[model samples]
Target: MGEVLSIKSILGQEEPEHMNDSMSEVDDDSRPPEKCPHCGKALKYKKFAIGHFTFGSHLEKCDCSGAEAEREREMREKERLQQEEEARKRMKRIEELFRQSRLGLRFREKTFENYKIMPHNKKAFQTTLEYARNFAKYKEKGEGIFITGDYGTGKTHLAAAITNYLLGKYTPVIMGNVTKLLGNIKRTYDDSQYTETEILKELYTVDLLVIDDLGKEKPTAWVEEKLYTVINERYENYRPIVVTSNLELEEIEQRLENCGGAIVSRIIEMCMGVKIKGPDFRKQKLEKGRDV
Candidate 1:
């Protein structure tokens, strides 16, 4: 009886071991298991498992929390690239427009980087820079600058520097020699390609007009009329004009004679005259050349 009881106990243990093996097989068959591609962790969930595809399903179907974060990161990168491309296109457009402007054509090299600022003219330089910094206010007020000084005192340099600075703000500047402007207008009578009206329109409409050697132009009835016309139009429109000259304010009046008062009046009304005093740099260069 003892031997039979021991045999029954051994059979009972073998049956339990067989049942445990069958349960393991059932669990494996219930779901296809695979490892996560990103983390290498075992995944029983079908959505998060590798080698599985779901049609028209959102990334949220994945069990890993990083799936949503990665999607967001990719979207942000795509947006950043798009914004960069837009900015590049905008900059190119701006360059093209500036290149076509009169200033870009006439004074291509008269930029701030090439301007020579002398120690004696520091205050004038600072004032010009400040004017550029506050250009919007000045433009709205129809205010401008009148640079009066001896020859070669860097008046042109400062004026060109202002234009160069203003270009960054997208303002168009036109610089012309007083004599040359009048000459071109006169030439228009014979030349069919350009008209006086068109030339004057550009002078009047530009954001900034810089007249170089203002008082040096030949004083005549025709020249005076044209000059006054240009100045008056700008005055009426409340546009800014920058003037560089070697004559004093009173001297300009004396030179203009009859139209002198009107022209000087407009100049004074529209601009603040800042006098620059310095040794003639040209004379200095000549003297140095002689010594050499």
Candidate 2:
């Protein structure tokens, strides 16, 4: 019933046909029309077909010796336990990724129509998506999304959807809130045991980073330097950094008053900005008497 479990169920049902289907498929007359292999009762061909396909031809319902049945039962249980353990390990890894990271949100499915592009910057929004799709097609690479929108717009939702899709596809990704992220780095800097260099190494080296709520944190000299280092490092390394901000680019620059013009220029160069405009999405939903 949960989003992730639902997604897993959906994806499991769509598994690729990697098996040799022709070899696995039984011939019309391939079934042995004899007594059950264990107890020697009359055989059922339909049941035989299913049993052979799953448990192998040796697993005749009742015709096999009791010893054989017991052995098969043990093997099946062992296989089931092994599979469950593997699934548990994978879930643990995902949970750890979510825990140590600053941001995490994912949706199983998304589309432009589902997002409903905002009205204030409608033309630019449409064009930006088109460009993004085109870039994705040709380069087969993820692009940074520098989203500008008022609070309650669907900016974060849309970004989350993209990150979710990429993660499900097995691509490397990191998501976290902006303020928490800055606070983490700053605190780590203050702690002599946990060096900023060590932490920054992982943050800068990640494949994709979504810094949600970009301008929410109050900037300090250290925060500004670290931010600049990250942007510059990611840009040079060609790793994408997506930033969602309630404040516009101009306002962001104003806040970083002494950070120098070049750093701002570099941030702009690395990012592909798109401004979003409309009634606050939450307000609109409320006005419509709709549950968010």
Candidate 3:
């Protein structure tokens, strides 16, 4: 007959005859691993000793969506970093362009914001400002402007302001007194360092040009031809030219008589003449100095 099992033996207070077989079976290394409830994926399991085991679920392969969510989050972070890098590159490129341009070196101090606009020359001020603001349209239209007035009437100031505005926008601008320009050209003839063709090419190719003191130079035959060449090239290319002068239309026409109205016609055709009238700013400064 089978041995009767006591209460102590059943509760493990004493070992039974079949205890070795049961313990060996419980710690079998070939036992099946646990599986995830949601995805049926095999879970991690380990047997340390007889009847001793550990189990852990890999939630990445389960219905928790942990792995997918993490992947998406990483992708979004990568995109954000990429966008910031691109913005930094664009800003650097713009700064480099502005530095390379060196377009407004001379007129750095002249800008629309600091211009002194008065009631007497309000029309001229407004018109000039409008032209500068709408420079793109004027450039496309190949439009130009002629600013005429008495000496020290803020003609140079307005013209320089336009130059500064264009340069700030990265547009090419060249400005200088007509007499000085001629002088430079003449110097190039004496010194082989600079060439007339090179100088003229720069003046003609600029996006906008400001020719100040137009009638200040004596309009000789050679001078007229030089002026004609500069004006005619710009006119043919449909480039804009801004002129500031203390002379009236009639005076300019008479001064450049050697061109037989050719130069006058070209100036008139390309530019809209606007007369600026006001008390001379230089005189005002002088009077103020005297009072002081």
**Which has the greatest TM-score?**
3
Evaluate all candidate structures by whole-model CA lDDT and list the values in order: 0.72, 0.61, 0.73
**What does candidate 1's lDDT look like per residue over 176-216, in tens digits?**
67776667677778964667776677777777888888889
Lowest lDDT block of 10, candidate 1: 48-57
Clashing pairs in 3: none
TM-score of 2: 0.56
Model 2 RMSD, rounded to 1 decimal? 15.4
Give RMSD to native, each candidate.
19.7, 15.4, 20.7
- Select the stronger candidate by lDDT from 1 and 2: 1
Give stretches of model 2 more than 4 Å off.
1-100, 104-114, 117-143, 189-195, 290-292
- Over 4 Å off, model 3: 1-107
List model 2 lDDT by residue over 52-106, tens digit each. 2332344234545774777789999999888667656654554443455533334
Using Cα atoms with residue i matched to residue i, what is each candidate's TM-score against the true structure?
A: 0.62, 0.56, 0.63
lDDT of 1: 0.72
TM-score of 3: 0.63
Model 3 misses residue 27 by how many Å? Answer: 48
